[model samples]
Target: MQTELSKRLGVEYAVFGFTPFPAVAAAISRAGGLGVLGAVRYTAPDDLARDLDWIEAHADGRPYGLDVVMPAKKVEGATEADVEAMIPEGHRRFVTETLARYGVPELAPGEAAGWRITGWMEQVARSQLDVALDHPIRLLANALGSPPADVIARAHERGVLVAALAGSARHARKHQEAGIDIVVAQGYEAGGHTGDIASMVLTPEVVEAVDPLPVLAAGGIGSGPQVAAAFSLGAQGVWLGSVWLTTTEADLHSPALTRKLLAAGSGDTVRSRALTGKPARQLRTEWTEAWDDADGPGTLPMPLQGLLVAEAVSRIQKYEVDPLLGTPVGQIVGRMNSERSVQAVFDDLTRGFERAVDRVNRIAGRSAR
Candidate 1:
């Protein structure tokens, strides 16, 4: 699994696992792959730093990184409340009505949903970035595209390589031109905010578009054969996020969601702009259907949309409202029927890649190297 990009990052393999759980992230690195922790869920700098501390202590001298949802431009004074206030009353009413229809109850008075996606908020992102840069991180990836020039420069100054997710050749080119160190070609089949193209079509295009720069193939990939396919398409590595959601280390906190994911097929997931203002692939549930409804108040964009649905999601998950419960997941959910340790998954992936190589060699009438 050694690739130029992987070697450049001082990792044994080119597999880059994107996960939110620190345990899972550290496990990936210990298994000889890069584990990029997702930092968007951390609303406080102290919490993020705490997790990074734990990851480093558990990684056994291996490298790790964190992903954040930072906007491309600078917005110094825009607070989360300011962004929340931008959401229209109609959207608020719609969310309230939808929750009521689902029979999801409000949280006990004075009780707050502990988690919210705060990465899009500038203040929170900067705090997260500050905490991340203070660590011994090998990479800092932006999920919302290339970070602002100042952010890129700061990461570079700290000797931290920067990566950004790209969906199209055009976006890849822009990242390359903007000094991005790596490009993760996330396709429409990916879990979170993604583009319209599938990995089969997007990976090679991104690789060709950003020649010499590393491209990590993402979306609908969860196995060794899939990894081989990504390499065959010219990707330097693979970026896996959805694959870890079902792993034992993942703390989804809802058994219902885990059961849904385990039982789901490729078609059980849908791409809807219900989670965020932008279109993202997630599980098909009443929650998604309501936002996707023709007569429903149209979905809000980005931050506003996230705010509009955050509380509803909290309540749904808190009560495990079966019909209204869902999560952002990719098409790869089909093959994730079992919960295994991260090392077990890596071992299977390694074995699978070797088998794929042997099969290809046999087809070419050549002995396995």
Candidate 2:
């Protein structure tokens, strides 16, 4: 169905798939849904440009989008210098000691020299935006907050729609003020960075708060009933993240994690700031447990925390270690065990929506009768 969102993005359905892999972005767009490439992992301009080029080539000319983390508030300018300055000597020492405790080796000569905490937020994001604008991306989305006004203006000038993610109605209003074309009302159940509110309650609150602006429901939505509930609550579409992690096309999925996700319950995930310096929902693992322990060193803010753990996470993945590392995931992971194609996932959502609509109509008909 061509809802306002679909019309805005010139897509066939309102389903938006968010992922870091370019292949996933291309696949979702090919499947008649808007796929958004998460650009946070691209550490350099050339890296982002390459990924965008790959996505464009594989997208088959179908519309897609790009998402960047542009936090509304930061440590004022939050440059690499500022981040380095703010990182307490004790915190850096703690990071080094923690890695040593885990038997993770120190970086080689000239290896640690390139790792600057604020590179993504300040430099890389700008580079990504420049590359994305040159491409045919239909939408530009900000993950943490409303994008900078200049960024929004630049997108608009290039005839692209701008969207921002929000955890509350208050945040929605802020996005609206910043001239964001869409608001993704994410709840506590969302993977990665998220707020404390539940989706069922937050969706309607955001929809009501940002009347004319479209709201997309996010968090804990993996089934047809969930999509129907969001639509009924005035959402124009649904944004899905964790559900796709277990998909066959996901570049990051491993057999061990796939099995773990299938067996996980809704309560298996926890919101911890251990990874990103912001409360993000991810599968509970020894890594997360270690950070939450009072005896353990507390996490650093945003980029610093991310920088500290990047090497450890890479090592864990390189070693295929399950107990030590897990990626960001939501409560929806429990229902995401099966390995399905992107097209198959879209088909399931369509069928679910139809069944849910039919069930509602039947109930209404019975009440009338």
- Top candidate by lDDT: 1
lDDT of 1 by residue, 227-288 (tens): 99899899999999998998998899999999999999999999999998788999999889
TM-score of 1: 0.97
Candidate 2 lDDT, 232-351, residue by residue in tens: 888998999888877778877467767777778888899998887889999898788888879877888777787666666766655556676577899988788688888888889888
**Cα-based lDDT at residue 228, candidate 1:** 90
Error of 2 at 101 (Å): 4.8
Per-model tally of clashing residue pairs: 1, 0
After the best TM-score superposition of candidate 1, give how far the Cα of residue 221 lies from its true spot, in angstroms: 1.0
Each model's lDDT? 0.90, 0.82
Give the lDDT of residue 332 in candidate 2: 89
Candidate closest to the true structure, highest TM-score: 1
Stretches of candidate 2 above 4 Å error?
76-82, 92-119, 366-369
